[model samples]
Target: MPTGSGANQATFAGELSVDGSTVSIRRDTDVASERVSVSLPAVVSVTDQTGEARYPAFKAIMGAKKKPIQTMSLADLGVDAAQVGWSGASSKVVDVSPTPARTAGTIVNDDGTGAAQLADFLAGRGFI
Candidate 1:
């Protein structure tokens, strides 16, 4: 990936989940997603199987709180010398958008009669 100043680049390979609107990233196998509303116990039990470097990982996590992150010019990091930016990156955004709005309406519950009411409501809009 092309690296440069003003570039917001972060590298992470781990399981993640979203609880409602909050996202939780786990370095272990306990992955969860509100979109799916489920936990992958089998997946969580397999993080050790990868057998990746652990010491560097420990240092990285520990360094986050104590280390003084220095802000330097791109030339100091050799990025400016290489002139890496969007021009150097392999990917470019062509277009972007948000998901379309839901066309369905809420179903009002009238106790045990909610089923028939729901059907009638949807049929009124030809949604059935």
Candidate 2:
């Protein structure tokens, strides 16, 4: 995710739908948003914006202690540790700096010559 979602709803879960044996995840793009469905028993990941977090009640917290806990490792999941760690990464970020300030945009005055001004502006920017 070198160039990440970048302030946009790159991977927003606009909505989620689940059934006994299937799941739905939202996919959004510049053109449209889509719902992708897959069979159940799958691995899924979502960002913080997926939904609001809820604190576990004291009773629920107590009950969790009585429940069985299952744990899996990278090998169990068929993922190689080296593939996901910085030690095996192909690139490292060496530095970060503040972005340069943007220049002010030109103002167009609408008068008898407004259209001509617009054409000139577009041509100057190679947009025409």
- TM-score for each model: 0.33, 0.43
Candidates in order: C-alpha RMSD to true structure: 13.9, 9.4
lDDT of 1 by residue, 6-106 (tens): 33322232544546644444343247322222222212222343357555677788878897888988778666544577767777889999999879767
- Can you write out model 2's per-residue Cα lDDT over 1-128, one digit (the tens) per residue? 32442322224555666788777888666898788776655555565657888999999999999999899999998878988889679999999999999999878779889899989989999999
TM-score of 2: 0.43
RMSD of 1: 13.9
Model 2, position 89: C-alpha lDDT score:
92
Model 1 vs. true fold: TM: 0.33
- Off-target runs (Cα >4 Å) in candidate 2 are 1-12, 47-50, 57-87, 100-128
CA shift of 80, model 1, Å: 4.7
The residue-level lDDT of candidate 1 at 69 comes to 84
- For model 2, what is the error of residue 116's alpha carbon versus the real structure, in angstroms, after optimal superposition? 22
